[model samples]
Target: MLRVHFTAEDLARVRVAPGPDPMWEILLSLHVLRQRSAAPVFGPWRTAVRATLPDDTRWLLQLAPPVGYSPDFLTPTAGSCPVDAGIEQVLSTPVASLRADLAQLDCPRPDPRTDLLAGGDTAALTALGDALHAYHRHALVPIWDEVRAVVDADRAVRARSFLDHGCEGVLAALHPTISWTRPVLSIESRFPQRDVHLHGQGLVLVPSYFCRERPIMLRDPSRAPVLVYPIARDVRLTCAGRRSLEALLGRTRAAALEVIAGGCTTTELARRLGISAASASAHASVLRDAGLAVARRHRNSVLHTASALGVALLA
Candidate 1:
């Protein structure tokens, strides 16, 4: 363990939520870069992208470069195999041939947009986007499977390296408290002592790339588990149950309930719905008080499950 000082309050604040600070976003971007560089294939890449940090920090900053500047900007020299060659090869192979070999196969027809986007024609960007969206929905599963195989093999090596180099502590620090609905990677740490206004432990990971210098770590004098990590980026989005539910129970509260679908921790619910953890907790509290949701403690986290009332309302 690299002896980094953190208090109990620091640890307590690390619940996952939506709408992460700026630093968390940066770390996610770096992770994305690492993912893209490692696999350049589909399955492992998607799996790596879907991998979540298993810590209790709620906020995550998602780093995204300008829309089109991702793997394209990081292309290697000519003659090098394209990162997605394996996916392309599989996708290009005759569907009947693939179905004959792979059991439980249900291949869809190829969309033109993927080919157009691959070609990078300015005139075809719109059509390509539409096609890519369709392709992503249909073809992503198989492609991700292929990418995952490569990514997993690489991760095994990296995991070994991480374990050997006393990097597990660092890895632990990077573990997220909550999982995001979208694919993301993020950093985590405590806040500065001066800004410790929140009652409970509070952790923050902003976008890493945006921070020119490392952030100051905030520790509670009371020796609480509060910490901070200067991250790269996090993802944020508003979530709601279906619109009908919203109409029945006012949008604000309905949106809160929608995000709690799988019995999420209060912080997780907040993060998924892109609201403050406090707000999420308050909303959940109201729902619980009304017998719309029930809170249960699992390990150290408090998770909320939809009650009969909630189920009926949502239904």
Candidate 2:
């Protein structure tokens, strides 16, 4: 894992000011760098690329928008989104073209074991690297600049509010490296840390940071393992107990628990089930009272994770 260092002041500035969009800027950078570096050695490993960054463009778009803003801004019809429909079309064409170009490039031919490795192959590798760099410099950078200009203009105020709310200090403590798809911001205090994960549809803001020092393996064989950090601590800030849970969990608390095996915030659960946040909270209360789930405080929100009993009951 590569560590990117930053001072506390830099962290604070990023928290307040609009920084690079992680999904488009950071993750994409990593993607290009990986392809340039690893493709020569590994022989064009597409799965490795997908593992690090999922193939879902919409998911990536969700994560790429500016910090503190809703993913709704990226929706095509919504004027709220930074990219206009016309601009989106323009930006997408080059990306599609690049993908096609890369796909057409020659990889290890069939029966490579029988073929002799040529010294001249280095030229081909060098050419690919130069092409990738040129694409990044010309196509990607321009599009990114356009996107950032619009997003930053709209979100400047909200970004400042986040900074005022101690986001800078939180980011300083966490010192997370920026990425395109993984837009992260945190606020740490003695009680719990607040973390926000920005996606295309919406932002998932956890009230407490979950400190998982080790990397967690994902069930998806195609995806890379994600390092689990404390994104939230006690989630009770949004849903404290049975009453609060009741306000959230809704009628089918048992079924919901089954779906959200890991845990989910009231907002996330409500959105997923097409219910209101208040209703979701109510459902959670019943589950909590029935000893099916546990609610804890993270930072400003509450998160509910299934208890072993809850899982067994669902089972």
Against the true structure, what is each candidate's TM-score?
0.23, 0.25
lDDT (10s digit) by residue, model 1, range 112-219: 433343455444444423333333333233333322222222223233334544333333534344222211222232322232333444443322222212332222
Best by lDDT: 1
Per-residue lDDT tens digits of candidate 2, residues 1-315? 322233444333342223323222322333333343434422332344435442323223222222222221111121122223323432333333333333332343422211211222434334423433443343344344333322332233233335555553333333233232223433222323233322222212111111122111112222211222222122221224566445444556656776555567788888887888998887777666655566654347665666545556567
Q: All candidates' lDDT scores?
A: 0.38, 0.37
Single out the weakest 10-residue window by summed lDDT for candidate 1: 54-63
The residue ranges of model 1 lying beyond 4 angstroms of the native Cα positions read 1-248
Error of 2 at 239 (Å): 16
lDDT score, candidate 1: 0.38
* Residue 263's lDDT in candidate 1: 60
Q: Report the backbone clash tally of model 1.
A: 81
